[model samples]
Target: MTPTLNGPPAPPADTRCDRIDRLRAALNRALRGKPGVVEYVLAGLLARGHLLLEDLPGLGKTTLAKAVAAAVGGTFARVQCTPDLLPGDITGFSVFNQKTREFEFQPGPVFAEVLLADEVNRTTPRTQSALLEAMAERQATVDNVRHPLAPTFFVIATQNPVEHHGTYPLPEAQLDRFALKLSVGYPDRADELDLLAGAIGDVSDARAGAPVLAPGDLADLQGRVARVAVQPNVRAYLVDLGRATRAHAGVTLGLSPRGLLIWQRVAQAWAFLKGRPFVTPDDVQEVARPVLGVRLGLAPDAARFVLDQILAGVPVPV
Candidate 1:
């Protein structure tokens, strides 16, 4: 059962909000002119979920991922996935030490607190599957030995939407692992001008400032998010929406039970971000699109239409 706010008290609201605001500022600095995208990204992180960024190259996806790592002051690792990439290359492998005459384990990028898998679909399915275990259970097993990853391990994977040749599409099972799929579109004219001006000033060469969050701060905030209450009626509203997805003719596969759970958690995080102690039906609707987009295997336009139908059909609880 999920915990309630009436249980143990969390950190003071003012303090948590200040830290979250600083984190938001840091992300805005990294990916200029996309506050909406940053909002969803922050919600996903607070929900302790992974992110899947699907867009064309050169859209600041890498910059956003790096900024997230820096904001939390965590170890960051990037994997440039390719067709020839091996599973062992990502999850590490056991090596025999000639001098010690014993096998030694070498950790891979998965061991980092934040991992960016660039061009994830470019890698073969075999190599992609290497991340499944690590993502789902926060552990990597090689040679029948299990290695635990960081407690706050987070992955921000990217894929090119327009490029399909020589790319392996992520199967539904793999897609279900992501909490939200986002696109960082082009910035506004003014923001782009600012970006150009900053570039001329060599802003890209500037190092990240002090982390917005200290060690263990993220996990503590996540715990607080989990305690954000979801009223019984709001939960019923979530269930109605999930069932609506299943019955929709446009949807081949609907939201799963795991997806429903994730939706609730994300709604809770959204409410917490809004400075609310409990969830409401509005919070559920606010996050429906991104949560369902990654799970439903439909074209973008059709997916939006189906989602619209589902949300419109469901009755919001008072």
Candidate 2:
């Protein structure tokens, strides 16, 4: 059963589909050659989950984050992380106001609907931990007082995987908060040429389409996604696959129970994006790389091998 909200009524199915198509087309125009990547990112967004982008610099990661924020018409904020950053900087602190004779709570970048933490690895562990509460609880604690963030708080963090100097690796606990980890690699030759040709213009083309779904609509859609059907067999398959990861010799840490739940939600979101009410094994497989890659922590080559083995070993429900 979908939870009913007192807010505005949800648009009809056809209307929603039309809006999604328009949004997708707009993103395609902006990204030029990354249809698959666009779909993956959309899945995470619809799932109401955080994302981590581990790629080299100048790969359009920041651009993708900004474009997503624009597409949703949400408040966008960015934090350029550095080793010297403090937790209070990301989560604003209270300052004493002389006129009011009290302290005023100041909201930080984490208060926005969409927050882009660029080069998250560049920050110290303490500063990185500042996102833990906000990412998990959708609230921030400043001076022991809680501040609620936007209803649709989504984080898109990017870090350079190849860079080790001046970088602090994200803790396992922090990494687990991200539902998916992705990479926006370089564009192909033709796409690169096209980008160069249009280099003189602004990124406004990405934000061309008006918001198709508002915060209320997103909340309702997420509720509907939660109701997406998964067969008993498929559920069993997920459990079995999770167990396999735990039993794998190469993996030091396996997917936790929370991780499993997040994996299922992402699959459900992917199905919803495809206009399906039921999830399929293919849906799970499609999102496996990003979901599993972040948690597995295997070498790139080894992670691919392990993921392939797990997927192959699991029996797909008929």
Candidate 3:
């Protein structure tokens, strides 16, 4: 086929798109030495899905959420889960108004654009349920009145792995709600040294950089991500891969339909971040470890083994 003059060539297969480049720079300051993770996080973000970060403390989980919120130029609220934390603390409460002669609903931390659900499993099941409806529907029905959240209501949830005392485990239902459960595993030695050097001087000036995106940009990104293309055979592969997980011998529980749908969305985000407009089997495979592995009920060590096996053998419908 003859090419037309004055037309730009298609982008390289492996270029981080401009928006993703901006996204990477935005979080690199706070999230040091986790470029791979930053990419997947963007995948989750563009997919319009919640994130569950499971790792040891002090690895920038809280900071990651804050940086993402700042990067997107959205409101940020932190919810510290405690044993005594109640559902009302999250979904807000209706207070009586004497002057107006009516009860007015006041929002809680959940009303923000990006909410950091810190130490989520520490709270009781009853209280955790407060997020179920909001995370799933992006709206909370409070006092029988449905309150719509901001269009980009992203939840970055975190939990401590070593510290489990007095912590309630997140049931499968809620765990399944998360699009991807990622861990910022330990940083490399050179990166750790870079961290130490980066902290040698005060850096408040770095935090003051103007946001690369407006609040509306994030919403636009979400819509654009939705417009990304996906093929039918790839869709079938996603379904088959998810079905394999449920049917695995070592696997205790498999990912549900919701999980497959969330994976599909995350795959789109992955492609977008990689500067592509179409989903590939590699996108699904790259995300399957984090997006699907967490849902598998294998023991921690066994989980890794099983994931490896799953990845090694899956016939990616090329």
Candidate 4:
């Protein structure tokens, strides 16, 4: 049996769908010609999971992250990660107050509702680990004291794929925390033309429009997403895919228990976005690539081939 969510009942399904449509439009405007990418981003958001965008520079990765922060309507904070950045810089540190003569905890970017860690791979491993606890628990501990972050805390991190000399690749543990890893490729010619046409306008107007969902509205939608029903056969199919990943000779590391759970939740969010209350085999297959890509620890090309093989081996529930 599915556990009942604790939040207030969600708005009517039609109302929720309309709100999602508005949010989608806001994101689409922010990143033109990538509606498919935007859809997965929404699924990750509604799944209450973080996002990792790995792509070449100047491909609208940062732009998309900023748009998400703006559309979500929260205290947005950005960190341009570097090698010298310390863990405390991202998670916060303690300072002795001159007046009060007591140590005061200074909250860092992790406290924000929307955090964008640009070029995350540019940071050292120690600094990269700072986000581990925060992303997993939605809380930060400083001076052994835990500070609760906003219920809607969301992270959108970007990293360059071509640069390797000065960058530290994200460990499997860190990659596993993200719901999906996406690449925002170059825009099509028509979209590029449209982009150039819009570029002539005032750049300041490019930001996302008014907040689509009010504060707490996103959390409600996420709660509703968690309650989307999953049948026994679909659950079994998910397990089968996971096992196949483990058995695949090409894959060095397979999906962990946590990854499997995240896959189910993301599929549930996908179903909710499609205006359905129950998860289907199609929904599971649709989100398979992104959900599995981040944790598979293989190059994009090799991973694609291996993923295809694994999917082919697993029988889809009827």
**lDDT values for all models:** 0.89, 0.83, 0.83, 0.89
Which candidate model has the greater TM-score, 3 or 4?
4
Error of 2 at 135 (Å): 0.6
- Please provide, for model 3 over 1-318, each residue's C-alpha lDDT reduced to its tens digit, 9 standing for 90 to 100: 112132333333433556667878888777888888888888888899999999998888888888888888888899999989999999999999999999999999999999999999999999999999999999988888899998789999999989988999998889888988888999999989987887777765234245678557777778767766777788888888887787788888988888888989999888878777678999888898788755775556788888777767668887
TM-score of 4: 0.94
**Candidate 2 lDDT tens digits, 127-209:** 99999999999999998889999877999999987879979999999999999998878889999998888766665544334
- Residue-wise C-alpha lDDT for candidate 4, range 1-318, written one tens digit per residue: 333243234324563477799889999999999999999999999999999999988888777877887887877889999999999999899999999999999999999988999999999999999999999999998888999998888999999888889989999999999999999999999999988887786757445567878888789888888888887888999999999999999998999999999999999999888887778989998999999999999889998999999989999888
What lDDT score goes with residue 26 in model 3? 84
Q: What TM-score fits each model? A: 0.95, 0.92, 0.91, 0.94
Give the runs in model 2 whose Cα sits over 4 Å from its true position. 1-16, 201-210
Candidate 1 runs further than 4 Å off: 1-12, 203-208
Give the backbone clash total of model 3: 0
CA deviation > 4 Å runs, candidate 3: 1-17, 200-209
Clashing residue pairs for model 2: none
lDDT of 4: 0.89
Query: How many clashes does each candidate structure show, in the order listed?
Result: 0, 0, 0, 0
